[model samples]
Target: MKRFMLTWVLFILCAGTANLSLAQSTVYTPATDLTLVGKVLPTQQVYHRVDTADHPDMPPAVKRLLTNSAGLAVAFKTNSTTISAKWCTSPRTTLSNMTAIAYEGLDLYIKKDGRWQFAGVGRPNGDCTEYTLVRNMAEGEKECLLYLPLYDETTSLEIGVAAGATLQPLNDPFQKRILMYGSSILQGASASRPGMAYPARMSRAAGLNFLNLGLSGSAKMEKAVADMITTIPADAFVLDCVPNSSPDEIRERTAYLVNTIRQHHPKAPIIVIPSTVRENGAFDQEVGKRVQAQNEQIKQEVAKLQRSGVKDLYLLSYPRQLGEDHEGTVDGSHPNDLGFDRMLQQLQPQLLKILRKCDLAGR
Candidate 1:
């Protein structure tokens, strides 16, 4: 009798395993129907730069830095009940306090009625190549947008839908583009998810396209970088690189960066944002003073630009933009999801106003 009971348990376990395998075997269709927005070209896998020597406009150093696909996204409308991602990254880990999801995960959003809503996230596998973003989604057709990894440099990526699902490009009417240049925080540092980053949030809230050129601790407002920014045609520009620059650097380079971009885009709105107050500034006087000095220099440069008759120029400042409670950052330096939300709340309104101004100018 005991032997019979053991045999029955084994049979049940085997059947359960078979059922699980069957449940996991959903066929995926190639996501070729989606419109690859945000990128410069259909053949270009990287978003912000061209191959070295291929373009006469940007310096080679700037081109090399642009290889990191920080702000690229794919937009589509689909009737699939399931979604998947097959992607590979050059580096699986960023070696920071930030998680792999913030660096390499695929962030998915759905358009309902007229607004974009966060749908789900696709976590990377152990090798950082394969991910099943969402399986068995709700039925019916919906517009979808998938944001690529913010920090991780993707080597190859592809979206997948359930077999025989209806898929096409999303017909979004908002065409104004906002270009952002800044440091690691703008590059999506310690945010728990990609969509939680301020740029992504602002993009959805304002219904505008954004090109993020945030280099981790490297955005020094260099002339080469400024030249690269000029190559892109955008409706508005946001400069937030004070955290990565010294007071001296800010004083020296801020004016030049503004002037260079203005030379290329005379009428585009340029918004200068000072650095967010760092978390440790309260206890560390030196850090506090350094940040303050940088901010002061930025203000001086913006004032200088305005004095010189640079139109469509604006400045945004908040003493405690991230938050006063010190609960907004992952570390003492980089913003967490809460910090990003706080930033979005403060910045989105100004962005909307800028977009409206651009619309009027266009008309």
Candidate 2:
């Protein structure tokens, strides 16, 4: 009896050791070695959509949000049976309306059938976290895109895989880069994860790389910010700034914003999308009037620009940007994932139509 008990204990220990050996952490490639997509500037900073050092004069809010990895992702190919990640993010007060995963988490997509599909998500723990993202996959080479946190600054990231699996960089799929400048919605305020942001979704679906430059509530289109935006040589420009701007600000700043970009781009198309009808406008008469006023004023400005020979300028709109049922928003202001999906349904085709005219439509 004593000999049998000792043998059973020894067997348990060996099994535990085998399990540990099966998932060792020896093969991690630092993110610096990978190709980072969805950035507005060429900087090696881990998840910066915009580089603050170059735009010292930008608003403090805009400067801080620049670090948010709204639309940034790392492209790589691996044949690992399991994909894992180790990453550290900045300390932040958890947002009340947003999910912890969406605020500061990693979203993974695997390419299959020539389309990117959501494979897994790296759920964040704290300032630093490590976890196996996906497992139980059949052995085969696969292309992968790992999206960084939407609202937090990622300090470091390392992709890990099973031992002996080959890991290599994948090419940036979207060839035409469009600079997406707007408010918190574009910065991905309430997306369930980073990839659900309208710009990120559009990139995967439309074949145009939309770099997120969302400034939260700070996309007021100041001339200083306009100058900074012009510095990035984007293939196209998208101005979704009206939601955060007042009717007066839109009237005063719209021409400056469009003209400054035109001075730099000359022919690169500029697509201006006015704010959606705030959901609250259904009841609040004053809110309804304000949104209408802003929309009408911006339309006039677009007409003036077109008359002045602003070629390839388009004013894109949808009757129900959120939805006909008015059920798409999270807080009657920002989009939930459903809200974003509904908006993308209309936005994707309208944008491609404008891009088609400029001979810059698809990848």
Candidate 3:
């Protein structure tokens, strides 16, 4: 009886060892093998450009916003249906019930019948150092777009596929891009998942690349940030910072921001979006007045720019921009997925018009 018991224990231990070995055998391909979009470098130190010598050190605010890997994505093609990833994220936490995956998750999409479709998402396991994004993908070669994290800093990232599967760069033909600068909503606050962020959704819908320069509460139309913006070539520039600015600040700074961008991009369309109507504004008279005043000031400024020969300038109003229901937002201010979808619905038609006017489509 003792000998039989010992043999049973040995068999259990061997089985466990074999299972571990099999799991370890799965191999990963570095995401760098394909194309890392929206960044000059695969391992960029900061999401936005900074003059290190001028500042020498990153300001706490800049560091905080720049580290959030918003608007970055990896594009590739593979024959294997099963896709996976391993990534490390910087230490951070949020009060919102947003999952670690949405805050620090990897979102996957595939081009099907000439349209980008949602595939699957990988959830991080409690500040996990490494996590598998997806596995057992459908077999056959297909183009894929993988969106990076929305609110967390990605320290390292890699893509994995079943061994012996073909992985190559996705030769996307859409080259025209829209560069967006805004506040927390643009930074994807309270988004259920990374790809659900409006800009990502817009990119797939409009067939254009999007460069997100959302700075949380700090998108105050700073001149220094505009200076950085002058460097990237884009088809259109979307300024959506009304939520972070007061009426006075909008009046004082909006012209300079518009002029600065105009100096660099002489003909590219520039869309100035006023703050969206917040949910609480329906009941909070003070909040409603403040938002209305800011929107009016921005409209006046944009009109002035147009009269001053700022060609291709446009203004998107605030009223009913996110829908009248007021159910789109997660809080009174930040949007949930529903809010984002509503924003997208409103923005898409205007964006398509701008793209056509600029002759940026199919180029």
lDDT values of the candidates? Answer: 0.74, 0.86, 0.76
Stretches of candidate 3 off by over 4 Å are 1-22, 40-59
Residue 171 CA error for candidate 1 (Å)? 3.6
Error (Å) of candidate 2 at residue 336 is 1.4
lDDT of 1 by residue, 184-250 (tens): 8887887777776677777776667766777778888877677667777787788888899999998
lDDT of 3: 0.76
Q: Give per-residue CA lDDT, model 2, range 80-158, as digits (tens).
A: 9899888999999558878878888999999989999999999999899877789889899999999999889899999
- Report RMSD (Å) for each prediction in the order shown: 4.3, 4.4, 4.1
Instruction: Give candidate 1 misplaced runs (Cα > 4 Å).
Output: 1-33, 40-43, 47-65, 172-174, 360-363
Candidate with better TM-score, 1 vs 2: 2
Q: How badly does each model clash, as a count of residue pairs?
A: 0, 0, 3
Pairs that collide, model 2: none
C-alpha TM-scores of all predictions:
0.86, 0.92, 0.88
Least accurate 10 contiguous residues by lDDT in model 1: 40-49
> lDDT of candidate 2?
0.86
Residue 71, model 1, lDDT? 67
